[model samples]
Target: MDPNAQPDRLSDLPDVLLVLIMSFLSFKERAQTNFLSKRWESLYLETRDLSFKESDFLTASVYANPIRWLKARADFVGYVRRLVDRIRDQPIETFGISISYPKPYLELIESLMAFAVQKRVKSLVLDFSNLVWRTYNDVNIEKLVVKIPQSVYDLTSLESLEVCACKDFDPSKLSKLGKLRSVSFGWMELTDLPPLLETSRLESLTMKECLVHDLEKISSVHLREVAIYNCDFYFMCIFNLPRVDIFKYRGDIMSFGFDQMNTIISEVELDFGAAEKKNDVSYDSYGIEAGMICEFLNNLLDEGRRTATTLTVCPFLLKVIPRSEHPHFLRPMKTKHLVLKTKLHPKEFNGIRLLLLTCPYLETLTIDLLPPSPIATASSYAGIDPQTYWMQNMSYWCLWEALTTVIVKNFVGGATELNIVKCMLRSVGERLERVELHMPFDLDESRKTFALAKSEMLQRSSMNVKVVVHNS
Candidate 1:
């Protein structure tokens, strides 16, 4: 030992403090601390959060060779069993295990889940999807799935649960989970979700790529956030919820009962994939599908119904809304903030104008210009002119008094962007306070175009407005 050696201040910390810091690190990262000093070799064993993934033990070369893959699987199984045995008596707050292949390790996984229940774990995550199998399309979906064991229902202390790539999961035993507050499921088939909602005091729920059949209605007094993405649904409805704050849905158009959401939601997102032209229904024809969509949007702000403070929508809704002169076709929106994710095409200009007139109290607006998808080129009404469309007789109370800020994302200095900006400036230039343009990459031409437009805008309108540009 050298007399002039610097003192090991970091390693000299107390064991309680060191264990508190190690609790935030992953299992693999905490293992590296064993090499720091002899004292740290056994300090990480006291951590209360244990998360393990099988991929952490295998290399790329081992995945490419069949013989090496078999040996690596055996080694991973042994490692997990030995590690869990060492910490069997330690109380854990979280227990997460991700296995790529679980067919041959059913008993082992059952023992691990039983261990979690005995340790009074608060959060659990069970993931069984294979990475290589999914990326290379080597195995069927059913071959990689596993069913939840009965021992999972004994986790009365669980507050959060996440299960992925599971099938035929009988949710009848979920009544025992009275302490659950949040739940998420993916790539699964479920029926009658009311049992879980009715039994537990759930606050947040999310589901994706699932097949739900014969669901009557979703009603939870304690729920605050709900998201359902790309799922096949049968007989699903949104019933009485008084405490919900945010709602998000993304999928094909379907009949959803929308007259019962009786709360003031903070935000709502409706993203229908690419905009596709329905051959059966024209823009003037109020067909069954088109009528259903219009009715749903109308109910968002109707009397004794739900209303959102912020609304986000895709281009499909703009293209499918019926262009009727009847007042009942579209209702006045109560949203204060509106976000539109679109390609800024000419055909959508009329819809944008209609929305501006409807939202009487809107204060801020955002237009996120998305890249054109492959199917967007097949739009039927692509020949409309923006200049003629925007130059019409209109009465917008928001533009005169309420609206102040406007933001444009992914700006590329296109003709459509210039025309829209000019139209906005003409309508509310005196009252507008700030305008922001966010560009994708560095482009000097875009900055120059904005500079010229800013100069002309100030010359024509009031000098109270501020224009700014940002590059990403």
Candidate 2:
């Protein structure tokens, strides 16, 4: 009976609802839907989101044949022009364009952006990573640097803007786009960022692999999250941010200062990876990198104690701190969550102990174990047994009564790992409610280690500490 019945129920839907459904389809699918019926064709034309990507034009054949690639690129440009023309008058809500950077395509891209602005698009994303090419000689081809057009800056309705692999990104060019809330710039060059922070109503800002110079301070009242990753800057300071709750930094900070901070931050992640050389307090100049790191840690901990409930410290950052200053620098804090990213070796065991002793009120502890570096393992024991080391440090061990949960990820259950677990079990006492050990799935020995760890914990028989072990 259904064979003869036409599927007109979908076709009978209202034009507005049909267009809404079409919005979720890809550009190619939406174009194909035009052949379904005249009603579908009309609704497809009214789709709100316009995404034109380079993959839509060329196939894998273009990679091996240069001539075909050229022709496909040209065809893509022509198609993009036609689509932009059709959508120029329509009310667009979001616009995204990803294309290889060619000199001839710049004007067309700008025209599309101008059209989107005129149509009051709310979100704009321009990605040009495809233009990057590597030669056989291992040299990178020069990238096309497109200065964002003024139309983008003037889009009053724009709420989000993300531009990748651009140059000369001056935030001062931005007009008062009152609705702008989120901005991300990647692989760009920046001179000053104050104007952008002071002018925009942004809630989040992220800069990745950008070249920044003389960025003095960022003072934003509306910002809730800030992430700076692999960026180069001479000097930078977060002067004032009353609402920021999450902050992450992953690059070299020549000189960092937090002049003002919110009283209650949810998380703070610090990754001092390979950025020590660029840091303003250089080891070569001061000849006391450890002291400098200790000073920096003190400042960070002081500020974090007032607000941050969770603190994450990378392994590289820990390597910079002097072993002697560990206890002093890691004084007692109100932080409830502490995460240590390190190789669980005998040498690092002391640092872990110092952390537990310092953060007396820590409710949750997470240890992310990385593979033991050759240097760390070779020098970790240094003829000192881990058990003996822990025995010597037992006098400094403070009762971690508030600690209710412990998570050890990437657990391999080596003697060092077992020793650390035993020490924690002893220190946490009967109040410990749960201990979770996440072992690597690829290692066959993990199951055996889990069994041993479970037995050892059960032998304590002090309290019903739930020992949960699972494959990571």
State the lDDT of candidate 1 residue by residue for 73-110, as single tens digits.
Answer: 99878978988999877879999888877889988887
| Residue 434 lDDT (model 2) | 84
- What is candidate 2's local distance difference test score? 0.69
Candidate 1: list runs displaced more than 4 Å. Answer: 1-91, 130-145, 236-238, 274-289, 303-305, 322-328, 372-381, 385-400, 412-415, 438-463, 468-472
Candidate 1 accuracy as TM-score: 0.75
Candidate 2 deviant stretches above 4 angstroms: 1-92, 99-104, 129-143, 236-238, 276-287, 301-305, 324-328, 345-347, 371-398, 411-419, 439-463, 469-472
Give the lDDT of residue 250 in candidate 1. 78
Highest TM-score among the candidates is held by which one? 1
Residue 150's C-alpha lDDT in candidate 1?
74
**Candidate 1 lDDT score relative to the true structure:** 0.71
Name the weakest run of 10 consecutive residues (lDDT summed) in model 1.
373-382
TM-score versus the correct structure, for each prediction? 0.75, 0.72
| Cα-based lDDT at residue 294, candidate 2 | 49
